[model samples]
Structure formats: structure tokens, C-alpha cells
Target: MLTDHHTHLAPDDDPLDEEALSIERIVAHVTAAMDRGLAAVAVTEHIYRFRVAKPAWAHPYWETQTQWDIDAYWEALSEAKAIGFPLLVGIECDWLPTGQEVLVEALRGRPWDLILGSIHWVDEGAVDYDLYSAFDHIDSEALWRGYVDRYARAALSGQFDVMTHADLPKSFGPLPSPATLGWAYDAIADALAAGGVCLEVSTAGLRKAARELYPSRALLERCNQRGVPIVLSSDAHAPADIARDFELAVEAAVAAGYSEVQQLKGRDRRPVPIG
Candidate 1:
């Protein structure tokens, strides 16, 4: 079965808000995935959108952010589960070195199927969105190195089951320089190897301006070399986007030498061969 381990049940561009997220709306995304023949999906919402998580958020948008009812969230996911929807409740948690304690505290005692770690910011800038981007003003090389190091830290944190969009450095702005790549891949390979956290192979890149897959061929190869397994996802932001461009992702995984992808049942996992 093809399982999407990482995805968001939210509209693409608006500031993160829970009122816009609902079990019925998320189930619509799941229904769309069923049309694509996907057996299941993990709807991992952004944790920063929650008000209780306000202290951990560095994004300017969070300042105006007023709603964060995680109880309502669990209620929705629980509702879907109760009704037999092929869905898993999860969150895309930002892996920040400084916010480690706060994040751990915020997520403590919560029952979630998967907590996918994301490296959305390098310092104060967002790589993908222009509103919080630091690309134009900062040194590209420095940001890249820091981003790589940040992923390593996230993997070692033991707070996440999957690392979503493992190649987020190339998500926006210009291409990262080739000079520092050797060590960067090595660092990622080593971290994932040691941490046992699966790398997320996302097709969102194909939709990005870069038009490449996350954890591009070379990085995927490094992960393979280090014996790190991968999880496939589209990082679907809308109902129509569930499993979008997934055939291309399967091709990319096979080309990178991955014969199987991971499937998560709660926090537990097993391998499913790619056909």
C-alpha cells in the first residue's frame, strides 16, 4: 500500500488557523487520496498554528494568531478514526534547537500517530515563503550549512518519527552552492542512520520553483548508502493535492535505489515495497 506519512489538512496560503481546519474538510482530502488509490494518509497539521504553542513560534504571523484548540483537533481526528476513515492524526513540528523544551512540553502526553520534523527556517527566514524569507539578504552558503546542521540536530532529537521535506534548503530562492554539499549529505546520512528517523521523500519539490524532488537524487543516494529508510509523501496542502504527482515520486524513489517505503501505524512502522 502507498501511505502518505506527511501532509497538511489546510489551505495553501492563509496564515495558519485551526478554525479553517476540520474533520470534515480533512476527510475530503482523504477521500481524494482514495480516488488516487492510496490506502491511507497522515494529516500532519502545523503545530505552530496552535495558541498554546505561541511561545515556540518565531514566525511573525503567530503574533496575530489567535486560535489553537488542540482538543478540537484531537476530536476531529478521533472522529475520522471512529468513522473508519483511512487517516492518521499527526503534526508537522518545527525542529528548532532553542524551542526544544517548549515543543516537548507542548506535545507532551498527546496521542499522535506521527510527528514529522520540519526545518522551515534558517535563523529567522523561511526558505519557501517570501514573507519570512532570509534568502536575499543572508549568505547562501552559511544558511545552507546551518540548515544541514539543523536537520542533523532534529534527527537526533528523538522527538520526531519522520523528517518531512528533507531537502527544504532548495525549496526556495536560488540553488545552493555545490562546494559544501559533500559534508552536508554526509551529515544528513549519518544523522538519520544513527537516529532511526525516516527521511521524507516529498514530491512537493516538483511543484516548487526548483522543480526537483526533496532529498534530490544525490542526497537520497547518501541516505541509501547509510542504510536510512525513506517515507513517501506529497505534503498535500489541499484536497486536490493529496498524493499529487506521486507516480513521479515512485519513479524517483526507484531511481534512487529505494525498493520499499515506510508506513506508520501510530508511532510504529513497517516497510511496504514499492511496486
Candidate 2:
């Protein structure tokens, strides 16, 4: 059996309000996933802590939404479970420098199966839509080093279930590798190891310019050596994106020397056999 480590679900309410994210659409998508033999999916909706100037790429439905109520979150998970769908409750959290309290309180008393911790913004004052733009003034080594350090903090902070993507900023920028930075990637890998953070083998990179999993092969090997676990995900933003590249990602993990991957059931992670 296969489980999608990350997915988004549209709620069914207020035809106009949820037209795009209606439950009908999400169920259709889930049905499609079942057809492909996927046993379950961890449903993660976006949770924001601050206001921002909307970007052109922002989804219209999400433009005015700022937070998700704990009640609403549980309701969605309950409904999915009632329907015999093994849905895990989770959130894609954006970490702010000062919002840890708010996140902790919001998560209090809630049984979250998986939490995808992501740094959607930098200290530069605005949320970076094109994450690669973060490396504009810095060399590749410094840029990647900074990003990885932040990831290490996020992991050690104990706020999330897994680190979403380790080196996503490169998807949007040009950088010098090995030329300007001597083995900076190794340092980043070491940070992840020290922090006890598990790396996500995201397939989304294949659809991006990088066209490879985050952390790359060498970094993954180092993570394996450090005994860090790995989980697979498509990070599916759209309904159809569920389980988009399981075969390729699993192959990549095996090549990186991981013999097993993790799956969540009722907030507990259990191992799944991998070849």
C-alpha cells in the first residue's frame, strides 16, 4: 500500500466561497488516487500567520483567507475518515521569527498527523514568491548555506513533523556550484544531520528547473549516513498532483541508500518497506 505524504483538499461549503476547493473536486481527485492504488494521503492546507501584499501568482481563493480554525480542521479530517478515506490531518506552516507562540497554541490539543515546516520568507522584509530570488546578492555557497542553516533551526525547533524541502531556493535562481563554494553543501548536510531533521524527497523539483530532488545525491547520502530518515512526497498543490512521481522518488531514495520510508497513521509514523 502507498500513502501520499502531502496533499491539499478543497472544502465543500458555500458554493461561491469554495467553488475552486469544493469537496466534490477533492473527492474526485481522491478517487483518481485510489484508482492508482494509493492507500491514503496526508491532507495539508496552508496556514499563514501574517498579512502580505498579494502577488500575481497567488490563488484567488486564498487571497483573503488568513487562518484555519481548529474546529474546521478537525471537521475536515473527521469527514474524510467517515468516508473511509485514510486522511491524515496536517498543515503547511509558514514560520515567522516571532510566531512560534501562535503556532504552538494553534497546534495545542490538536492531533496533527504530519506538519510540513517551511520557511516561506526571509528577513529581507517580504515573502519571497520566487524562492530562488533569495540568492541575488550572495554567492551560491553562502546562499545555500544560509538556507540550510534556517532549515536546521526549523527542524531542531521541534515545531514540525518533517522538513519540507531543503534546497528549494535554487529552483528560482542561478548559482555557482563547487566553484565559489568549497563543499558548502556538505556543511548544510551536516546541519540537517545534527538537527535530527528528516529530509523530504520532493518530486516537485522534477517539474522545476532544478529537475532533481532537493539535497541532491551527495547530500542524501550524508543524510543516510547520519541516520536521518526520509519521506516521499509530491507536495501536490493541485488535486491531480497526488502521487505524481512515486516511482522515480522511491528509486532516488533507494539509490541514496534508504531502505525504508515513513508513513503516518493517527499521528504516529510507521515504517514502510522500500526496495
Candidate 3:
């Protein structure tokens, strides 16, 4: 059965909405996933959306997002699972160098099925958010190199189950030549393999300006060659987006020589064959 390993409870644009973490919304997301032929999905809300994660987020944009209670989010997901829904409680954690300790401490002892590591911020600027675009001032090469360096570090940190959107810098536009960045991809693959972390094949880029799947074919092949396992994700922020563009995601995986994908539960994982 196909499973979506990454998703979100809050609206990407309006994470502070009171109804974002409601049990009703959780149920709707699971229902939508089932309708899309998915056996299960993980509701991985962004870590910065919770007030407790504020210490790890220094960007002013993050200040506007630390409005929700993580306990309430966990309770809501637990309630949904208790009622027999096939959804996993998860969180999408951003990689912040200055606040790694605080972030790790805050996430301790939770029954998380999945934790998606992401690098949305390169230093202080955001790679995807138009309001604080890193691309505005930083040249493509510097921004991409900075992002990859952090991605490798995050993969080696042993803090995440899957690394989502491996090439997130392309979200706003094209990046430097992939050939020149082969060393970066190798570093990421090596780090993931050493840390026993799975790489996420996300279709979220298809919805962004990049208009492509994450971890370009070249990078995916490198990770596969390095024995880094992979998980499929849409990075969906709403019910209708669950498993969106999955056919394309699967095709990309198959092309990259992936015959299986990882399924997660309570931080443990098992491999499921890809069709």
C-alpha cells in the first residue's frame, strides 16, 4: 500500500488559524488520503507553527507563526488515531544551527511517527518565502551551497527520519548547474547513509515555481547508489493536497532505481514495495 510520509495540519499561508489542528481537519485529511488510494498518511505540521518551537526559530516570519500549542496538536491527532483513522502523528522540523539543542530538547519523548528535516532558511534568509527571499541578495551558488551544507549537517544530526525537499533552494527559481553541485549531493547522501536517515522524495516542488520533484534525478540516483533509503511525500498542507502528484513522484522513484519506500510508525520503520 502507498503511504504519504509527510503532510501538514496548518494551512501553509495561515498556520495560526484556530481550526487548523482540529480533529475534524485531521479526519478530513485522512479521508482524502484514502480517497486518493493511499493506505496511510502522516500529519506532520511545521515545527515552527507551535509556540514551544519558538526558541529554534529566529526569523521574523517565524515570530508570526508561533501561535499554536503543540500539546493540543498532539491531543487532536491522538484523538483521530484512537477512532481508527490510518494517520500518523508527525512534525516537519526545520534545521536551525543556533537552536539545535533547544529544538531537540523540545521534541524529546513524543510518540512521533515521522520527523521530516527541512532547510527552509539559509543563514537568515528564507529560500522559499517570497517575503524574505534568500535569492534576493545571495547569488545562486552561495545560497545553494549554504543550503546543501546545512542539509548534510542535518542529515548527520540523527534528529530526523526523513529529509524533505532535498533541493529546496530551487523553489523560487532555477539554481546553479547540477554538475557543479555533484559534490554537495554526494555529501548529503553520505551523511544520510551514515546517520541512517531516509531521503524524502517530495512532489511539493511541482506546486512551487520550480515545477519539478525535489532531489533532481541526478541527486536521487546518487542517494540510491549510497544506500540511502527514501520515503514519498507531498508535503501537503490541506486535505485536498494529500498524495497529490504521487504518480509523478512514484515514476521519479522508479526511474531512480527505487523498488521500495519506507513506512514509519512511532519512530520505527519498515520497507514497502513500490508498484
Put down candidate 2 lDDT per residue, 141-249, tens digits, no spaces.
6666566556667777777777776667666666557643335456556666676656678887787788887657777887788888778887876667788988998
Q: What is the Cα-based TM-score of model 2?
A: 0.82
Backbone clashes, candidate 2: 0
lDDT of 3 by residue, 59-131 (tens): 7888878778888888888888888899898998988878878778878988788888989988888888888
Q: Residue pairs in steric clash, candidate 2?
A: none
Per lDDT, what order, best first?
Answer: 3, 1, 2
Q: lDDT by residue for model 1 over 1-275, one digit each (tens)? A: 69887777775456444555665677687888789888898888777767767787666765455256777777788788878999888888888768667778877887788899888888887766788687866876877887888989999889899987877767676655676777788888899999999998898888887788888899898998888988888887887877888888888888888899888877888999995
The clash tally of candidate 3 reads 0
TM-score of each: 0.94, 0.82, 0.96
lDDT for 181 (candidate 3): 76
Which of the two candidates, 2 or 3, achieves a greater lDDT against the reference? 3
Candidate 3, position 105, lDDT: 82
Q: TM-score: which is higher, 1 or 2?
A: 1
**Candidate 2 segments whose C-alpha is farther than 4 A from its true place:** 10-17, 49-70, 125-128, 136-142, 179-184
